[model samples]
Target chain A: MRKLSKVITIFVMVFLSVALSFAQGSGDKLGDQSKLIKTLNKPLTFVFIPKVIHPWYDVVKEGALAAAEEFKKMGITVNIKFDAPTNADISEQMKKIEANISARPDGLAIAALDPATNTRLINDAIKAKLNVITFDTDAPNSNRPLYVGHSKDFQDGYDLGEYLAKLINYKGKVGILSGSLTAPNHVGRVKGFKEAIAKYPGISIVFDRPDNDDLQKAVELTENALQANSDLVGIFGCNASNPIGAARAVKAAGKTGKVHIVGMDDLPETLQLIKEGVIDATKAQRQWEIGYWAVKYLVAMNQNHTIPAVHETGSRLITKNDL
Target chain B: MKKFIKTKEMSMFIALAILCLIMTVSTSTFMTPYNIGIIARQISFIAIVAIGQTIVLLTGGIDLSVGSIAGLSGILCSLLMTKMHVDTLSIIFISLVLGIILGCVNGILIGRLKLNAFIVTLAMGEIYGGLILVITRGYPILDLPESFAFLGQGMIGLVPVPVIFMLVITVVIAYILENTPFGRNIYAVGGNSVAAKLAGIKVENVTLYVYMLSGMFASFSGLLLTSRMNAGQPTIGSSWVMPSVTAAIIGGTSLSGGEGTIIGTIIGAAFMGVLANGIVLLNISSYWERVITGAVVIIAVVIDLLRKIRSQKE
Candidate 1:
């Protein structure tokens, strides 16, 4: 048994090292082309790191690839390397950023999962002579220049809040289903929603539930809010899965079409709910544009150190009509 | 009845009853039929998974990969149903077989090959979980057939279908544990493997079967959850591992092995479900839920240790 376990451990170590070396080799291959323009003599390589591997990030990858294609058309030979942890983890993101930096890419783009832990890493990468840009999530305290990302999450939430209020005729009790309270983006959205709802004196935020980004918890929170508040006319979800969960809750409560729901993000389930009229609307982040512009900005920064410090990629509000 | 009250399982039941009473008194919504139905349905998933964990625990082993098996089976079942146009029942049958196969891998590795159960299942979990992401690409499979939802979302009169499923499983497992020779051998193997081997029991086979059952139960839960959500979500089973283990431990299943009851695990899962419901009903901050849950689990473990020491003295 001991010998078998030893063999297994050895096999796993060999597999991991092989995978790691492949990751490094692929990153280096992008810059190996010898023939290029005088100004862009060496093939420029940039690594785009997201918080995790999700459908949202897949769309972002598409945008980055599109930008890479455009750069290639311009004879600049821009190689955009994309990688993320299999799951959403801050430490994993940190490790990936460190690995990317060691690969000696011309530039690096990352969506920081936590500003405090990642800011120092971003600064270290800058010190290592890697031009760093952040998209989707920004670390303003870091020395990295240029943030090509979304509009204020607060505005996204405020718009959903105001839109939900109008959908319910501006006079009803509403509940806010949010993700983790400590998450900065979720908090900002909730703040904006609260501020927006305060304008209409008739609209009151009666219930505040944080689901920790679990679909089950989100559903339970929404259901409990409904059971507690019999007169709840609307629910505003400040995270991607919240609206889908709220829609399920509303349907289970037999309050479909009666209870209004607006959530953030364009998850497939959320879109299906909107088409079914279970959800009134959803705030769709411009993930593609965020990715496209981040790569473009990184390339421009590598070519000439003259790029804007901040760029805002706006969001869209999707309704049943859009479906 | 007096003897029942003195047993650890009864204490767990009392804990559940006390928690429910507190919730009912604190919030009018807690006693409502809607809230009760939702809680019952929610408890069903964890309860089913915990049964598998309890059996594995009883056999002096752990299966951390149950959650990943759940996720893999759900995604695979959904894909078979929607993409290949297979009927729902067949898809479920296929998932059960797949679960057994996946569990057999762990069984062979740990039971036959004598690898450490903890490390073997943990490695298997990562592999299965990784497969889930690769299959779905982090997107949910949203094209489930309408008929499939009946397993999870349907109601038999006032009780939800999932709750019914939970009850049926509990009864079957309870009967097997109390009435079957195979079940008795499982306890024997867990109690002392060398002694059981000396007594002509096939310890390796018992270990393999328990893990296979665990895998089967976990996959059953995966299918139910996928049906309830009306999609095959890659995130379906990530949060289940701890809760299932917690349910087993809280129900008086000793981690060292050879002692547990299905009834006790049912109450343990119910206790957890009620606690979460109470937190929501009382308008308590959700941020405190995890902290409270961890503290309560620790308290349960301490109490279990105390009971063991007292029983030893007796």
Candidate 2:
């Protein structure tokens, strides 16, 4: 009986090790796909669709326009058509995507609003022989060639959380002002923050609220949160507006340096706050990089060059010192 | 005393007191001096805007363009200050004048041309909102002068400067609504426009003035908010329109016309502020806050309706 049990334990250990190795191998394969070299000297047009006409997407446009300029310098005409819906409505986004698909651009980049609907639209575009890639917000289930943007929103939040935990000495009450509860990116950030803070046993989250991406609403919510938890030591602003809002509230309550603020995005107001020492830090997503790479990768894919499945334009943690 | 107790403003006051009582019981921080100050400063902006909304409601018209006017005025003022090197006082004056001009355009269309108030203002709102986007291109104008911050972030003996402005504006507007012949004309015009016209009130002029006042109030709030934020944000007044209307309605201002007070509107604004503050103090889920706020607005309106029906029967 002892000999049989030993054989079974050895077999089980071997199976588990093999499975782990296979998982790692697959991860590497997805991340490190070798680029297939191709050169195509021709004029091309690409359509880029974002979720909404926001300032954030404006930065993305800048990056894309820069890439187009770069191609122009190389004597290749890369016409980038940047179209976006005025509102973040799923149906409107779908309509825009359908219109673009029918137009049949050489390459298409989309920030998916609704994953299921967008996946179907992306598949239709694929059927039309248009090379499609996702940016900013991805429709992973679709037949898109690649995703190029800040893919790790969770990591952005987790890193900020860890930085904030360290700032507060890993102990005290904290508050999270998540922008838009329904947004997948905001939700992922909030989850990451909660998970990161949970690792520190002494840290407790006393307040969690959604500001709906409104600056004034964020200010009101943060003020209320500060009032509710007088002993609160830190705040995590899960979007651009929230950190500036939190900084204002902390300044108003005369708790400026007493409460640490770690937030996402480096809007001008946010950077100003950081410079003034009102905000501790912020994680600015590489928006320009997302736009730059989406254009480059789309051009490459159109030329039949193989690129990595995901291109994560990482974020930068901006502190007062960094400014 | 009996007559006071029967007033809509009085009822709103009582409701507000009960809400405060509940909040105080539920949380130690609700009644704190610090929280009160915060609530006061926060409510002052909407309350000021609601004052004009109350007047517009009294005149049987709505100004959906107030929010857009606010946003545009703020952007214009910030541009003047930062780009053109305009002085602080001149910046304020210019923005307010610009607001009046915007309001005048709406008035000329709705009052003189006799267009539908809802459609005219809604379209005007879209135009103004679009202009804000076009002007700023989704960027916030920053680096406002330091001296200008006092209007928003300053305090006098623990009362925020904005609160003082709110109270002063409330008193003046309340007096105008309750005492003067112009005030009587507003009530008369709102009660019955044909009757008011026969009674020798220039209905168009009154309409024009009310909208102008609404625009001025909105611009004032925009200025204060920009000062507070230390930047001119394009998204500043996008959320103000619904709340301005909600505050007036909650204060027992009749939507049809001729039935609300500035004091009542103030109380309505305060009620909203307290409810929002209390939600956080009570640690309620953020998702439930909107649900509660909507229910409260409905309840307040229903109470007003029930009172009207009871009085009619009596």
Candidate 3:
């Protein structure tokens, strides 16, 4: 019984330690460089809140956190609070926004899960006299001071179309493993994909499977699509997970030579898959740039400085050859 | 009540038969051996978990943590094999054991403390999910050996290992549910917990064992999935919860507890798998799959409800 008690106690302690450890992050002494950033016109605090605690946000978080320290000497205090909800809940995010507002930060850097769900909260934050800048997923028309992420969703989408068109030499039946049709970003990319493919007379979108932004579902859906259409020319994943799914499914189905695939985002898995000749190419979204620009935009907004109203972090087309 | 209860379980079988007839006429590929293999492999994970879950449901409990436990164990196994330099088989075995431990935890709180199983498993699910993120730092372990990969990708005489796992688990669970005294105890406990206590059933032990079994099944899927991907991502099994629950319910397992079957759940999973396979074979969009799945789940339940009503009227 004593041994049981001892073991239980150890388990609890270990579990707590692991949970608490994540909350710490790399909070290292940014104070060392705080003075160099003291040139700010006023004391400002910018907060970057993510939709979830997934590894995808790690780069963006580092950007905002580092920028906070960089601009701290200029009387800027970047308060990075990212205790995102359990499953990327939009309602929980709104509550967090309220809490951030309660903290009365000067500027906010947030990547919205659903623009429609969070628009009112962001608008309310704007009315509360806080500066808002979107990163990754944007909430446009929310009266944010500026947008500071990817320049054009079209470029990302077009890259896949262009790469695949060139691969099949623009002459075959290609399919699209599209993402959530309702998501504006996904919708915009598909539009761009269609526009790009239209330039190639022979390349037609015979099959477009909008996969609701799930990888395994994409795989299953893509697998069946491939089986149904063995004579298909190529495939384009309209989202990050979509491409990875397409690639994996294509590989699993042993259709590597039959279909050329590409998609957007540089998810590590996607990158490795590209290296493995699964994905033909992926349009890289520089996460560090999104973070860097979000902080830069927030810092500028807090100081009442007018920079370019629109900022694009720029994108790179990555292919197997590049890898 | 007994007649109504029996019909709810068989409704999906009817649905499956109807879908097969329609699919055979509509798509030539639907009846192929390869497609059948794909269909079996596709539903194996859900089938495996649902079989175990049906047992738990028979004892008047629910386990919301199965998906989380699968994901957690998958990442844990990969991390053990890759980062900690543990032997691959040992890592897989330990991960499965951890899943059982998680289930046991759920059983202890729900059975011994007499807390609501729904609330306890839900909270435990969240806790298990958090541990997954914390342990992996949100990155997949990419370097699983070729043998592990082969386990996920390889097949024995055209049958995927996962499907075999599903079939084996189903048979074992069927034996336990039908041939064992514990099986009898399950229906008794779920039929009426108060009576079960008076009739000398070890209620807590049964409850605990059922959940542990659920975890073990989930762990099997997790290991298979990690091997298939040759990596372990934190989000590996997020889409599994609904399918697992739907399979159990559609298989004629009563959510209210006291009656269910392992074979029935397996068939239900295969039925759902065929539907998903049909959708893909026909080239339906992936996003629509969700809407369709939700609709199918609702229709299955409604049909089950109707079957019960008809039997009751009889």
Candidate 4:
């Protein structure tokens, strides 16, 4: 019994140390930088909220905590509190923002899911004297001082469209799989893709299916697109799941090499597909930079520094060779 | 034949026909063999799960955990294959067994313990979601074997394998609900549990089996999806709970219990599938798809109610 108690005590000690390390790992310190700025004389608390709890936002949270560490180094005890809804929900985001407002943090950074529905709440956050800044899907019309995110969604789609057209030799029909139409970024990408397709008159969009960000629906849409358009040469997916879904359908039909696929976002499956030659290419967004810079900008603003109205974190074209 | 005409399934059939006619007129591609194949394949997953849900509903119980069960089972199957080197067939078998065990958890709570079905399943769904997150950490499992894809993406002659699975499950369920003594017991249990108990029927067993069956079907559907995507996705089946209930409800399955047909549910699934296809084919703004679908479901239910009232008056 004494030996068992000693073993239990050792186990509890090891468990506590492991848990403590995990807690500290989340509070990443900012890496070496070329420029130096004054640290805050007093401790300031900041809240960072994302649209949802996802792997993508996990990177964003890393950037925010890193920024907090940077502030801490400057003699400011920057307390960073990160909170978000369990799912990608707009109303839940609003409630979190409201609670943050009640807490009266020194500043707040948010990535809005529904900009229109959130515009009033954002304005209210500003009305409450909280330094509110938007990242990722921005609330442009809101009273927020700066919007730090990717370049125009249209340009991203246009580039993919042009690349795909050239790959197909400006011929045959192509299908476009998109996310929810209500999403501004997805709509912009579709418009840009259309504009690019218009330049290649030989290539026509046979069908466009909205999967509502559901991967299963994305698979079904791709199958239907292939079935409905027998002459299809390629597909362009506007979201992470769209390309993976399209690739599955293409592979299932034994048309992998023949049917080229281009998609947005560098999801793990998308990267795997690219490595396997199932997906021709994907446009990799600087999601890490979006988060990293958003927090940096928020910190500067908190310190009475003026920032740009729009910060464009550019995208990269990733192919098989790049992988 | 005359009695068949008066049935709710006939009215739903007429609605589906009218919807198809409108789609055909609006889009030249709507009636193509390819498009029909897509609709059938797309309806298979929801339809299969709904068949299980319909069984539970016939016993006056709701299974909100169907979607979560699918997600959890798929993730677990994917993990076993990727980490443990489990063979394809055995992985699927183990996943289905896991689903049955999970369902039995609910069965024990709702059936044996006599807890509220809604609350029990809702809480269980949360537990399932948490377990999936713990296992997957929000990342997809991509090392699916080649042989596994056949179950989801393969075709026999002209029909997709998933569609075949859907049809087989539907036929078996329809037989069980219509011809078997256990089928009558289900109706009896749902219609009146006290009377069913008085009539020498094992009410608790029927309840437990239906929930178990719901879990099994959900797990099977998840495996099909894992095959289709060629990966095990953490987010698989997140949008399924509503559609499972919707398909059964639209198929003329009474939520209050004791009235529904698998054929009606199949037609209902087809109706929804076609409506979505029509929106895409006609080039209507995709934003209107959800609005239109919601309106159609309401209109379909209202028309059915009106038909019942008219028949009573006659």
Q: What is the C-alpha RMSD of each candidate to the true structure, in Å?
A: 25.7, 25.3, 26.1, 26.0
Residue-by-residue lDDT tens digits, candidate 4, A1-323:
99999999999999999999987766544553323444456677667777766676666667777766776677667666566655564433544565556556677888877665466668878997889988887878889998888858999899999999999999899988977654567878888888999998799889887787778999998888888878789999998778899999999998988999998988888899999999999888888787678778777876777689999888899999897
* Per-residue C-alpha lDDT of model 4 across residues B195-300, encoded as one tens digit per residue: 9999999889999999999999998898887776566766667667887888888878888887788898888888887776665555443446667878877887
State the C-alpha lDDT per candidate: 0.83, 0.84, 0.75, 0.81
DockQ of all models, two decimals each = 0.02, 0.01, 0.02, 0.02
List candidate 2 stretches off by more than 4 Å. Answer: A1-323
Over the stretch A1-323, how does candidate 1's per-residue lDDT look in tens digits? 99999999999999999999999989877885532322667788777778766677778878988998998898878776676654464433544565456456787888877665467678868887888888888988888788888848999998998898888888989998878654678888998999999999998888987786778999999888989999989998888888889999999999998899998889888888998999999889888898888888877776574678898888899998898
Clashing pairs in 2: none
In model 2, state the lDDT of residue B286.
36
lDDT of 2 at B202: 98
Interface RMSD of each: 18.6, 19.0, 19.2, 17.9
| Candidate 4 local distance difference test against the native | 0.81
Error of 3 at B54 (Å): 1.3
Between prediction 3 and prediction 4, the one with superior TM-score is 4
User: Which residue pairs clash within candidate 4?
Assistant: none
lDDT of 2 at A123: 85
Error of 3 at B70 (Å): 0.4
Please give the ranking of all candidate structures by lDDT, highest first, separated by commas. Answer: 2, 1, 4, 3
Stretch of 10 with least lDDT, candidate 3 chain B: B280-289
